[model samples]
Structures are given as C-alpha cells and as structure tokens.
Target: MKHSNGAQLFLRNDPAKTAPLSTKKPLTIGKASTNLLCMPQTDGVADHHAVVRWSVGHGWLICDWGSQEGTFLEGQRIRNCRPISDGDEIQLGKVGPVLVFRLAPASSQPTPEPAVKSSAGGNLEFAGQLIPMNQIKFVQLLSRPRYPASFSWWALLSLGALVVLPWPPAFWTLELVVLAGWIVLGSRKEHVLLVTLLDGMAYRHSFANKVTALGHRNGIRKAIGQPSSA
Candidate 1:
C-alpha cells in the first residue's frame, strides 16, 4: 500500500516498531500519560520530552521540551527547533531511544521497478557505487555532517592534560594553541549517503549533496522498488 509524502519514525533497536507520521496534529513522544506516543519507561526520557509536528511551510519539525537529558538530532543536541528530513536519526537524551526518520510513499507515486533482475542478480547503482540490492539492509541520505568538524576526542583529552599547567599564562597559551590546531585540522563537510548491509556494516559515500530527503527517497524507490517486509 502506498502512503503520502509524510514521514516514518522507526525504532532503531526494534525495526518492527514504528510510528507513521502523516497527520496535521503534532505527535507527542514521551514516557507519560499525556503523550500520544508513549515510549518504553527508560532513563533520560522526561514525562513530556519531544514533539514532531508537520507544517505546510516547513514540512516536518522536531522540537525539544527542555528535558533534563535533552534531545539530539544525528549526534548534536537540539537547542530550540530544527527541521527534520527523511533518513535523519533522532536520538532521545544521551543514551536513550534512537529513532530513524524516513519519507513515506506518496499516493501519486509511480509503480516501482522490480528490485532485482533475474539475470543480473539485483544490483543497484547509487551515488556512483554499485550495490547489491539484496545485501542492503537500509539506506539513509544525510544532508549534514553527523560529527562536528571542529570537535575531536584528541582535542578534549589534550585540554584535560593542560589542567596541570600553571594558570597564569602557560595554561592559556597551550589552550589557544590546541584550539588553533583543532581548527586547522578540521575536516571538510560533505553530503553523506549511507547504505547499511545485512551484516550490520555500513558503506558511506560523499558528494555535492544537494538532494533533498524526498528526492533521495524517490531515488531509492526507483532503485530498490517498494519497501521490503520487516
């Protein structure tokens, strides 16, 4: 069955569990009675944690409700509000539940081509890479960098090591030098295209990255046909 141009939220740990969002009303996700979507009783989730709403102007929007643990998109903590697209991962709290967002099939969508050709053995071409359709467990299109370009674990550890230095000027100078080094070594930001294999390993591709979530969804549909049975 085909759906509309909405979104699907899938539980990362449990792929069978899902929340389909294609409505006008905001979907409330939390661990309490008032929420429309009740998450499992777990640490880090507040009584009323976060909300996913749809607007004609913005498409989909995710907002945090000032929880103690906080909500995260990809890996960055959400501050006020952020626009969400297909294939984006939303992590609740620091070690809380993880949800993957996907674009729903539109009602007017065309019939998908066969996922595999009997003679060719199901090969798919994506982002200049040849993928075996049967081996792909999932596909995600990322518009932003998952990790902060300027932040690194080595930089943080170096800063911690400098705590033993004298406070007046030695510590300050080292801090500035470390910060400059981090900036100089920062990596370039590019669009990320991820393909997860059945063995749980993932392949990544980076490029010009101008495609929208919906555009990626359509492309995947054409490449792999309809969604596979879970």
Candidate 2:
C-alpha cells in the first residue's frame, strides 16, 4: 500500500491520538520516552515493548521484544516478527491499550511485480526450482527457533575454562560476555517459505532473513493471482 504520510497508528478507542511511523528505522512502542509510540500512562505497557518497522520484501512488520505481557496482532500473540496490513489491530497486552494501523491516503498505490520468473514456458522459478503455477496449492511463511550447535559447544567450553581459570575478577567479565552471547544465540530463529503443491508434496526453502522470505512469499502470491495472507 502507498501512503502519502507513510503509516500511522491511532488509538483504537481514541482515534485522535495517533503516532506516525517512520520508514527509516524501527518504531519502538513502549512506555519509555525513547519509544516512537510511547504510551506512558497506558496500563500493561513495558519500558521496551514492541517494535514496528518497514521490511524490504515484507512491507510493515511488528515484533515483540520479550515483553512481559506480550504483544497481540489481530487477537493472536505475535511470537515472531509478523507482517501487518492496513486496518490491523495491535494490542500491547491482553488488556492493554489497542492501536489500529492505518495507511494514509495517497494518489496512487504501488503495484509490485511478482518475483517469479519464467524458467520453461509458463513454469515459475522459485528458490532455484522450477514448477508449474497450476501445481501450487498455497504459500505460507513458517518460523522455527534454532540455536547453532557450534555455539552450544563453545559456550560449554567457555564455562569449563572459567571454572579453572585464575584471576577470578578478570575472567568474570569474559564469562559474562559469553553468557550474553549465549542468550542472544538461543533466541535466534530460522524462517522458511513452504510452498505446497496440489499433489500434497511441499517444497521448503530456508532464509536467514525474514524480509527476503516474505518477499518470495509475496511474489508467489502475485504470480498466482492470489490475495496476500500474512
């Protein structure tokens, strides 16, 4: 969707109170002053809650940063970064303040071409594989949390070294660093684009980045003349 003033988030109850979103950086939604969509007085809002940002192939996406109460998109708790559309309702918590996503008026909407390419005749080329468009049943985005096996081995080795190392205070800093790295790695995830065929066989392509994955999904939908479903 094309909007003259980008996108805006208005309070569900009080539409007058609105927060304009920026395409440059991820908009932070929280009770802190640093957040672009600050809800200081709102109940259940955390300091560093959720974030909304424009992605490359995914358009707009909202993600919860391990918030206490959690963030909900259209009544579903947002586990991973979820793509959002116009008129979508986002609640900070189960009973927290609600914000409605809006795309401001514009003269013309963007018409993006499908990423699909003609490999052989009318067959579609996706993820380096060629398949007929007629065989496509549906396309969906899937996510799974994954921590690198190497990281676990390195973490265990580090902890073991810390146990036997001298100079307790000096090595304590390194231990803390390792712990932080482990936490970050544990939260890492892998995104996949699963294209199911009419024959019940599915083709899965993994993407390290969600934006690229969403782009492929959007392209497939356009190629098949199907509506976008996030």
Instruction: Identify the leading candidate in terms of TM-score.
Output: 2
Which pairs clash (backbone N, Cα, C closer than 3 Å) in model 2?
none
lDDT of 1 by residue, 1-230 (tens): 12324466888888677786744477788899778778657777888899887643346778898888899998999986788977899988998999888777676323344433333257654543456777777777666644464677557756685777857587777777877766655544457667787899777767554455445545554555545221
Runs in model 1 deviating more than 4 A are 1-6, 106-230
- Give the distance in Å from residue 223's predicted Cα in candidate 1 to where it truly belongs: 43
Model 1, backbone clash pairs (residues 3+ apart or across chains), number: 0
The candidate that wins on lDDT is: 2
lDDT of each: 0.69, 0.78
Mind giving the per-residue lDDT tens digits that candidate 2 earns over 1-230? 12225578888898877777765667898989988777798898899899987654466788898998999999999886899999999999888998888875554323332347433225664553557887888999988877767477667868786777777886787777777877787778899999988899888989999998888888777777787774
Q: What TM-scores do the predictions have?
A: 0.44, 0.48
